[model samples]
Target: MKNLLKNGLMLLTGILMLATSCNQISDSESGGNGKIVLSLTDAPFPVSLVDKALVTIDKIEIRSTATVSSTTEVTTNSELFTVLYDGDPMEFDLLDLQNGITTELLSMDIAAGSYDLIRMHVTNASVLLKDGSNFDLKVPSGFASGLKIKMTPNLVIESGVESEVILDFDVSKSFVVQGNMKAKNGIKGFIFKPVLRATCQKYSGSVGGKVFENATTPIAEAHVQIIAADTILSSALTDAAGNYHMIGLPTGSYKVVCEKDGYTPVTVDPVVVKAREKTTLDIQMATATVTVNP
Candidate 1:
């Protein structure tokens, strides 16, 4: 998935939404333990000049909350997140995660309840600039707080069943460039402000389409983005053939946008994608000439 960016002193924003899915529960065990398998994936972000973006994750934390009620009163209990993986932190370059590829994170079995929050702790971050130089990116107080993503509604796990979750961390949008590019140790390095959530693929579908300049001319390398409720759901870059696809989106209505420099942006609203299905929405852009005063 790719992030769309605007140039100059304008505001910059990148948002990646999460999709969660699970398999059907069997009748063999109606009241047994459930399973949760965690994984990491990311949508495409725009490539302006930066070459590589990498992050190191040392730990992950998850919490489960259960509600109980009896004749006397009602009570709620929450299980704190434990150390699921204790090995050294692994570095990942999120730019290579396009085309729906994924890396395994963790898997565990827990009681039937709701998993509300997830936190990923990082020790260091760095980026490879286009100038053949690598620099350490700063976290900006993320060392103490790490990166936190809240599941407001929470994810429920039933007994005797299994669920697979994919955390789509939008690394392109998670990076915030502050001050001058030469100011590395002086608050200029990219800040790791992650935007992510948990989702399942079994309950989601994909959207595909082509971006073109005209009916016969396909627009290659354009950025296609899907937005729902003003939030960026998925992003992609058009291939050499001017084709773009957004995978693992839940069934809902969204607006599709195709944008390229020196071309008029096109947005098509109300594009819907159903579960386990693929929806196609095409876009055509017109050339725009901009005049800068001398």
Candidate 2:
């Protein structure tokens, strides 16, 4: 009788252990979703000429490939696309977001998986010049279809993790000048062709510092660029405070150059950057000397 009781207890214990293991497996597979924190940033714009650059975004969407149960409806574009945000249109001045600064656009919970692309719908765009003149910028196809940007390295969201994504608007490249800046009526107008890039914060690094002519004199409106293999990776202009910042760089060594109209350009090579790290590099430039003919 004692043997029978002992065997029964053992069987019950084994069953309970098995049930606990099964529950753990279920939780690990589908316990919860991940989160995404989206933000906007801009490369240095020519603040000396352009006073303000504005853009209004109405909707945002993401493309994922993970086979998870979702309530997202199949859009005409693709079934793998999901609407991350669709609400009030938010307008932002690109000039205000620079020098390592950013403005949060949206934040939401997303399924744990891999996302490859992001599309942003732009409703309005305009530019104001320092001369008190403004013009409504035209957005070709972006008004209807949205501006599509592919992720450089595919974004991976793990269960219960919060990921940060930054959308960088390149102002200098997007706005093409129609006329010469020095000639009267030289500045006819500008054509708007939106150029944007996306980066994941966890896998990228940043570099920033002050550009100066001397220890106390800051050089404003100076161009700072990062170069690799004779190509420019990214660039920024010094603010009034002589500060410039370049973000979303992959982990590697880069050559940095700082130049202005009147000052001699300075170059620093092999500046190493690591993931999630910020490298500080302050540069001092001297005035360019002109050669006089005898």
Best by TM-score: 2
Error of 1 at 130 (Å): 2.3
Q: What lDDT does the true structure give each of the candidates?
A: 0.62, 0.69
The 10-residue segment of model 1 with minimum total lDDT is 5-14
What are the per-residue Cα lDDT tens digits for candidate 2 across 1-294?
000000000000000000000001122454368787776777676676778888887778888745324664423365567887779987888888777667777677888777666667778788899998898977775336667666645677667877777666766666666788777785677777776766666667889999998888999888998876776666788888899888767778999988898889899998997788999999999999998999
List the candidates' TM-scores in order: 0.76, 0.83
lDDT of 1 by residue, 151-270 (tens): 544556678666666666666677766555444543235666666645555576778878888778998878878888887777877877888766767778898877887898888888
Native-referenced Cα lDDT, model 1? 0.62
Residue 230's lDDT within candidate 2 is: 79
lDDT of 1 at 125: 71
Minimum summed lDDT over a 10-residue window in model 2 is located at: 9-18
